[model samples]
Target: MIEEEPRLSAQEMIDRLEPSLSLKRRVRAVAALLAGLAGAVFVSALWWSEPDPLPGRTQLVFALLTVCCLAWAGYGGWLLTRRVPLFATDRVIAAWMGLAASAATTTALAAVAVQRGTGLVPALAVGGLFVAVALVLAVRAHARRRALLRRVRELTGREEK
Candidate 1:
């Protein structure tokens, strides 16, 4: 027997759905933007304000760090301006980006410690913590995304019939 389409109101539909872009997400997006911009500015200032000329390698490293910060700021801005709500998929992508960033930063710190022949142990310990946290977040994000996808499929399949 054919059933009539269920008339779900807009608010009712929203109430039933999961993962709206909430206030917390907006605040996080803003925080990311501000932090990235501030970091870039601070790094650039340090890079340019040194009394003595820095080595070529140092200059290149500063430039790369600045660019990375700018990229993060751009990502935050994009998130803020997006018309659609960011869902589990976006979270997964962001978590992975964080993991990569943490890994890169740890590697950089480790290299510098080795180069200077000091503080290697502390650097590794701190970096390891960062990497571990990022890995956990990424894994959780993937799991949540998978669960959301499964739920969506189930809901749509039921609705379509």
Candidate 2:
């Protein structure tokens, strides 16, 4: 025998789910903001430190990474502010873009760290650690967002309706 799914009124759905969605979105936003702040600090360090080999190239890469972080934070914040239903594909697209931006920033940071003449092994190890952590977080966020989109579809009672 097949069981029918319980139907919930729109108000009931909102009441039951809005808080959880809001909390998750807030957490993601905070993470993005913190990442952006970290990038800013990195940029400042590059600017104030004694000249490194190819200082110009290092500075350019650092600046690009910092900008990506800032942009990610701003985009995340805007999504939160707009309350653009998480079911929207735009959320997924933005998340994907943010992931790319984070990876790019991580790569640039590693390059800058290496160019600064730090011991090769230690510099590479630290950079790899940072990249690994960021990758894990990004993957987690992407998975959660995908689950959220699926839930939204289930609730709407439609598959691309």
- Model 1 clash tally, residue pairs: 0
Estimate, for each residue in 1-161, the C-alpha lDDT of model 2 and write its tens digit.
99999998754663454343467677777777677777777776776674666557766776776677677767656655654445444355555665576567556666666777766676567666666766676677667666765665666665531
Winning model by lDDT: 1
Query: For model 1, what is the alpha-carbon lDDT of residue 115?
Result: 93
Error of 1 at 33 (Å): 1.3
* The best candidate in terms of TM-score: 1
Estimate candidate 2's alpha-carbon lDDT, on a 0 to 1 scale: 0.63
What TM-score do all the candidates reach, one by one? Answer: 0.79, 0.56
TM-score of 1: 0.79
Query: Looking at model 2, which ten-residue stretch has the lowest summed lDDT?
Result: 82-91
**Each candidate: what lDDT?**
0.76, 0.63
Tens-digit lDDT string for candidate 1 (1-161): 99999897644443355445567777877887898999999999999898678888688789878877887787778778865534465677678778878887888889899999989999999999999998999999988767755555564543210
Q: Which regions in candidate 2 have their CA more than 4 angstroms from the true location?
A: 1-7, 18-54, 87-102, 109-118
